[model samples]
Target: MTELHRIAIDTMSGDNGLSAAIPAALLFLKEYNDTALILVGDESKILDELRKHNQEPNERIKVQHASEVVLMNESPALALRGKKDSSMRVAINLVKDESADAAVSAGNTGALMATGRFVLRTLKGIDRPAICAPIPAASGHTYVLDLGANIDSTSEHLYQFAIMGSELATAIDGVEKPRVGLLNIGSEDMKGNEQVKAAHKQLQDGGFNYIGFVEGNDIFHGEVDVIVCDGFVGNVALKTSEGLAKMLSQEIKAGYTKSIFTKIAALVSYPVLKSFRQRFDHRRYNGASFLGLKGIVIKSHGGADDVAFANAIGIARKAVIEKVPDKIEEQLQKHLVD
Candidate 1:
């Protein structure tokens, strides 16, 4: 029998709120036989939503009530102290107490990270928890870390990010020796600032496969499995990539519909275009893992739809099943002892 994995979801959070999360939970339950869900939110509203779908809390599904809701623009400190009963916090509390294997939230990123760190705390030897998410690449995808969790990271922090990211790739992608790269301005050894240079030196002697310095363009090359950088740089790179993808998509659509001849050409190339779109769909990569925490917490995009939110739940399930946090702690211990 498959061991059951329970995930706590912040149903009252995100842009679409229950409309997206409830449907996503239903979809996820239908797909994953061995996993259960605990929808965290106002009980009455949750029950109403389930009733709308002709469903109720069953053996595989449960409800946990949270009276408060965190606003999107709310400050992290305010959300942490002022809203202890918020859906986001309650869901994370379930994970902290081991009542659920993981927590999934499409809430404010800052509040989610802050609450996660304060509640679950960081694993030993990790100074800060970093946001790690998958980015579309040429082959499969590359996991990039410190996406928006820390604006300024020291050399040791970058080294820790590499270790956590490498282990994440190993667990999720089944890559034995995932190639790790330090994101730099250029590929040359003399290119980056002192922090990156120091990180490169530390990673060189680190146990895993260190691929030296990688430039920004190398992210989509699919050669490096993990790219390490400070949160500020990583967040900028992520947003830029998202913007570029959007622009390219719009441009392609515009070019394809300009004339009758192009319209016919679009018809001919429909299959290929669809395949490309599916390959790089941002919705498919919606979940971001908060690494270095003692437990698993996945942050979905605030405006994620049902499909995107379901994908985030799937990520949480994967992390739970793979024991990602435990593996990360073990890796850190090994590195520290060495």
Candidate 2:
């Protein structure tokens, strides 16, 4: 029998709360036979939602009661210091105590990061943990790091993000010597500020497959395996890309429904349009891994629905199976010792 991997879900933390998480858990359980879930939230509410779908606690599904729910706008400090029994904190506690292999939450990004760092702590040789997630690319997808965990990062932190991003691509995507790049204003060596330039120098000699510098456009080129930047820039780029994708999708639909002629044209192009939609659906890439943590934690979008939340759970499952934290630690130790 395959070893069972358990994931703790903060069922009370997302925008849709139990509605999204409960259904997502059921969907995920149906797909992964060797996995179990520890749903962390109000026991009564969770059971009620499960029963709505005609589900009851079983050997594979367990419930852990958490009295509080972390609000989406809750301050990180408050959530960290005050909401000790919040679903988000409880879910992360499961990881720290080794009760669960990983934790998945669609809560406040700041709170999740703050609580995760406090609870599991960063791995040895890592000063901070970075949020890493996949962005759709031309060839397939590219993983970017520091997606809002540490808004202000130093050159050393950027270098650390590169190492962690590279290892993640290797472990999760099965890439060998993943090409890593420093996000800069220009592809030239002297285009960015002090931080980017300093990071570029460090990466050149850092021994990984450093690809010099990559601009914002490079994120969609699929040529670079990993792009590393501070949390501020990465977050802006991610949000901009999301906005652009949404605008383009809306424009496409509006254009297709403008007139009877266009409506007929849309029918003719339905297959191609569907393929495009499926290829670029943001829901397919819902999970962002908290890299450099002692344990695995995935952050889903707060507004994620069942499909998207289920994708987050799948990400946690993959991270557990690949031993992502161990791989990152091993690489960090090798680099630090060298």
Per-residue accuracy of model 2 over 149-231 as CA lDDT, tens digit each:
88779999999999899988987889999999899999877689898899998899889899889999999999999999999
**lDDT of the candidates, in the order given:** 0.94, 0.94
User: Which parts of model 1 are misplaced by more than 4 Å?
Assistant: 1-3
lDDT of 1 by residue, 1-338 (tens): 76678999999999999999999999999999999999999999999999999999997889999999999999999999999999999999999999999999999999999999999999999999999999999999999998989987999999999989998898887999999999999888889899999999899999779999998998999999999999999999999998988899999999999999999999999999999889888889989999999999999999999999999999998999899999999999999999
For each candidate in turn, the TM-score is 0.98, 0.98
Model 1 C-alpha lDDT versus the unseen true structure: 0.94
Question: Which stretches of model 2 miss by more than 4 angstroms?
Answer: none
Q: Residue 159 in candidate 2 has what lDDT?
A: 92
Cα error of candidate 2 at position 55, Å? 0.9
